[model samples]
Target chain A: MRVNRPKDGDPISVALNAQERHVTFDASRGAEAPPELVQLLTPEGERVEHPAYDIDLTPEEVRGLYRDLVLVRRVDMEAVALQRQGELGIWASLLGQEAAQIGSGRALTDADMAFPTYREHGVAWCRGVDPVNLLGLFRGVNHGGWDPAEHNFHLYTIVIGSQTLHAVGYAMGIQRDGADAATIVYFGDGATSQGDVNESFIWASVFNAPVVFFCQNNQWAISEPLEKQSRIPLYRRASGFGFPGIRVDGNDVFACLAVTRQALKNAREGQGPTLIEAFTYRMGAHTTSDDPTRYRVAGELEAWKLKDPIERVKAYMFKNQLADQDFFDSIEAEAADLGRDVRKRCLEMPDPHPLEIFEHVYSEPHALLTEEREQYAAYLASFEGGER
Target chain B: MTTLTLAKAINEGLRTAMEDDSKVLIMGEDVGKLGGVFRVTDGLQKDFGESRVIDTPLAESGIIGTAIGLALRGYRPVCEIQFDGFVFPAADQIITQLAKMPLRSLGKIKLPVVVRIPCGGGIGAVEHHSESPEAYFTHTGGLRVVACSNPVDGYHMIQQAIRCDDPVIFFEPKRRYWDKAEVERGAAPLAFDRAQIVRPGTDVTVLTYGPMVKTCLEAAAAVEQDGRSLEVIDLRSLNPLDTEMVFESVRRTGRCVVAHEAPVFSGLGAELAARITEACFYSLEAPVLRAGGFSTPYPPSRLEDHYLPDLDRVLDAVDRTFAF
Candidate 1:
């Protein structure tokens, strides 16, 4: 069942023969019984069988997924770089959140609805939403450029914990419609403190809504570490709300994939919502405006680098003879191409026409919008006549 | 069909919405068994069961925050803030979260949640209970705010608020909750966010809403007896105001007076004055006068009569507008 665990005979072993890779394996075990942390794949390349959880992913599928992860990370990097270069006004980097997002996002069926915070570019990518369109929002060209129905992805909600409630409500709607699809909501550690998030927990638990609250607790919510927000573990907080929660290694794609699948299935099967605290690290600054160096040290960043999500998968591939050097090289090349395309597309995005603001405000037109749009157009026209 | 008080109308509205849609849930302190402190949600839990009409803890933020979740789950949630003053605790959810959700979502999601707050001063109650905070929600985009001044509106508006695709802050004038009227319970509902001109005239446009609608109507009648024609406009929809109606009236009368129980500083009066001035600049012959509560906290019940902008105060503002 193991898909991406490292091997004993890989270059990684030769490079670090004296020391073993530092992974907290025992931490994966928890008090709960049945739905144990669904991990078919281990961090090492050695394949191991899991009695409860297993996956029958093919070689081509494995290669294809590796490519997706690489491309997604590259897009994330390009967006971050664009933000730093002032091409984007702001960016919420998904630097360390790639595996958790990609794993959970790929698990969703086409009919499933996704509710995301500002940092779900990886999930959006999995949903086939053009990443360039997401940049239009931060670039001040438009608010949100993608339609939710088109991609089954809700717009990025910025007010911390607000989207969780909306997700629960949407789930309630799904239940009323007698639909089998589940709703997945994404949020950060900081959002857990919000009244809305807590309330979402209450509603989801009481109503038995078909929702999976995927909390990517990347340890820090804008310089405030996890300890500042909660005294107990974040996953344990779900128990108080009458639901099961699990802590998974967010950096491990296999762990994230397996756990998220179980959680989503649990919801769709009418068992109610499950809270997933993807325990990981924020490998980059919170956003373009953030200076992580001011709050954290380089050593902390280096420490997480050893547990790199993509590197472990690469190691597993190399050790298991899943792919050759040429295959890995081609994937890297594809990632580079994705990076270049993201930059080019982001630059070419047109500033939304002023009239677009008045559109989609309501499905039906109103007298006020018409009058205001007319007045605004007149005001803009007057500016054109006066200014150089 | 049924003659009911505004309170009873609201109670029936909750009952009907819950009956029509199981997803339509009601949550607030005492909303379950006690039917709310004002009994506006009375007998709902008994009919629909505790699952639909829930009695939540005494946390305004908790009530609203969870309501947002319920709405997200495809449940049309109607949340009650125990009192006008108690809404402040959950103001962050209302102002920052609920107000901007639809726009932030780029219209991908519609928040059909209704926040019902019993507002305005007249019952000689505490300070926070009487304050009119509609301007705050009105200023916030992605939120529709409306106030019901009478039993008819109280009934129809509650149903309309529930049916709206957008989130609505339904402000029930606490003073007028007990006001009885021969309400047509089965009448067709009005538009979601449009103002209703309760009393029309050609002399001047008297813009008012909430409990002050009665005061403005009384003032308009008194001024008519004094040989001065006056138009009283009941602004049911505070946000997305019925500026067209006000503008049309001002264009004819060349004068205006705005009234509310809230303080005048940056209040609904200010909004009306600015919009009227912009839309009817050349038509206006005099300054827009405002009759509202004084620049002070809602005083004791003994001083409430003076604190609330009554018929005399509104007429004085009308006189001042004519003087201008």
Candidate 2:
């Protein structure tokens, strides 16, 4: 049931004969290749049906997804505003990548593991991590704040593409432990050029690790365009590494959810890894300090305005009778309340004391650290309470 | 008891650790089939199988990053950096992430990973291969840096390092890999962060470690012939320096000289001198002296003999220490 090459044909039958098998490849033949997009809802207030996979969401569940997208965006905006107001040291805005993060984030079960880059505040939100915990990393206080065992979500990795390999390794561990959980690793388009990312792909394909490589193609890596990052389409690049590649409209929450759910099921059932290129745009600056006006033209931003992830979902909800005016008003209230709570938490975060720096260095104890802490404590005590 | 070389001692130490803890794993390039370039990890893969002993891709940062996650899952990983120069790509991970993860977690989580790097320059190697970069790790907090001089310390210290709850940088002096000594495999050995007085003398205290330990001891022997006793102490752990032993020797000898193969400015020698002056200021017979490489890049093989701190250079520092 292990097939390493995408071009191979005989293995498809072998995979079908397996006990947990399901129909994956569509049988419809066409002269031109299928546009990799799978959708149950369009970008402009329209509901469409997918011939391969259909969506049967209840009214409450549909409204819930919309609420998640709006609230996650609200929290994102608050963090960005905090950065501008000198509250945070730095911030990586997940402006247009919300649907990509939230959609894929909500697709996993509680048993699933997730690896995130520095820009995964949206994913962290979906994983039940408080906004304050996310702020601790950007503040000078801590590196990561959430426990992996609790939420099955790892801390944000800053080194470009390094988390991909870690995700692959964890997936291998999952396979060895005979767990039915699949790992999802999130990275940007910029990371796809790194050696670690490519190496992760090769290892994932070779070992058949139950993992998903979710690449958020957010157009600009600081200032470099997607054109500079890759020549061919990003999704097609996955085909070269012996995995099925899919290009989904990252701004479409329904499409993102459906595609990600399918990919995770395939991986958990021992179908190996899949590369998902969520083609989205970086609507905001790369981080708090970045000024996007230097590299990009205003026309490009105007063009992407039509593809706003939240607005399209809102349009669909209003066009259909899935959500009424009361639901929309209540969601707005919730978003405002969440934003206020985040602001209060960010401001009330007490600065860690100097002595707190030496704790948690080792699980047992170190003779050297114990000595240094003692000496450092005396040094700190020598100073007055008001001022050092 | 067995008389094993430094290389074989490390191999045995790794083997013992893997056998003792099922969660302990060994990872590096060429570590599985080749048993490491120096054979320090020999026969491990055959016994532990490919699942436990992993041969990683040619990426240093990748090895360390994944090891961090594995540690989060309650696994102890011992990573080999292959050579001195190869560790730089992982320096970012070591200095920023690995060093900060434990304390940053605020006593909730710990990263008990060991990074074994083959260091120092006397072995006729090309550019980037011969480097002495211990200062970088020693400067970082939340990391314990230690170097082994001979077979006995190499064996016991490695086991202690693995059992330790902290992330330890175990630097193996490449030149001393072939040197042999009888080592004991036991429950516990020397204290993890304490310094060992290799040679006890009185006139002057010579502080050194790793490859320079042998050179300092040789210089001590030569100085003994000249009607002078030189106290040679190996500061095994560099970060949390065994200040008690250092001050004790400096208090007796009254004169001190520090030797290492790294560049002179801002090297481990500078830190040792600063600490000694702070600890034993009144006991000084002369100002502290240092013998180290020049403030430049490691030179060609023909000039490396000059670049490395040999017995003559150490003795010269001793002469300056006494003359002061």
DockQ list for all candidates: 0.36, 0.32
The CA-based lDDT of model 1 is what? 0.82
* Model 2: CA > 4 A from native: A1-35, A49-55, A139-141, A361-376, A383-387
Candidate 2 global lDDT: 0.85
Per-residue error at B18 for model 2, in Å? 0.7
The TM-score measured for candidate 2 stands at: 0.90
Candidate 2 falls in which docking quality class?
Answer: acceptable
RMSD of each: 9.7, 9.0
Residue pairs with backbone overlap in model 2: none
Q: In each prediction, how many residue pairs overlap at the backbone (N, C-alpha, C within less than 3 A)?
A: 23, 0
Per-model TM-score versus the true fold: 0.87, 0.90
Sequence-dependent TM-score of model 1: 0.87
Error of 2 at A280 (Å): 1.0
Error of 2 at B142 (Å): 2.6
lDDT score of residue A77 within candidate 1: 89
Deviation of model 2 at B240, angstroms: 1.9
| lDDT string, candidate 2, B1-324, tens digits | 898999999999999888899888898889998999999999999999997888987778878876776676677889999999899988877887778776655666677889999999888989988888999999888889999999988988988888887899999999999999988887468887899999989899999999999999889888787898998999999878888999999999999999999998999999889988998999998888999999999999899999898999999888887676
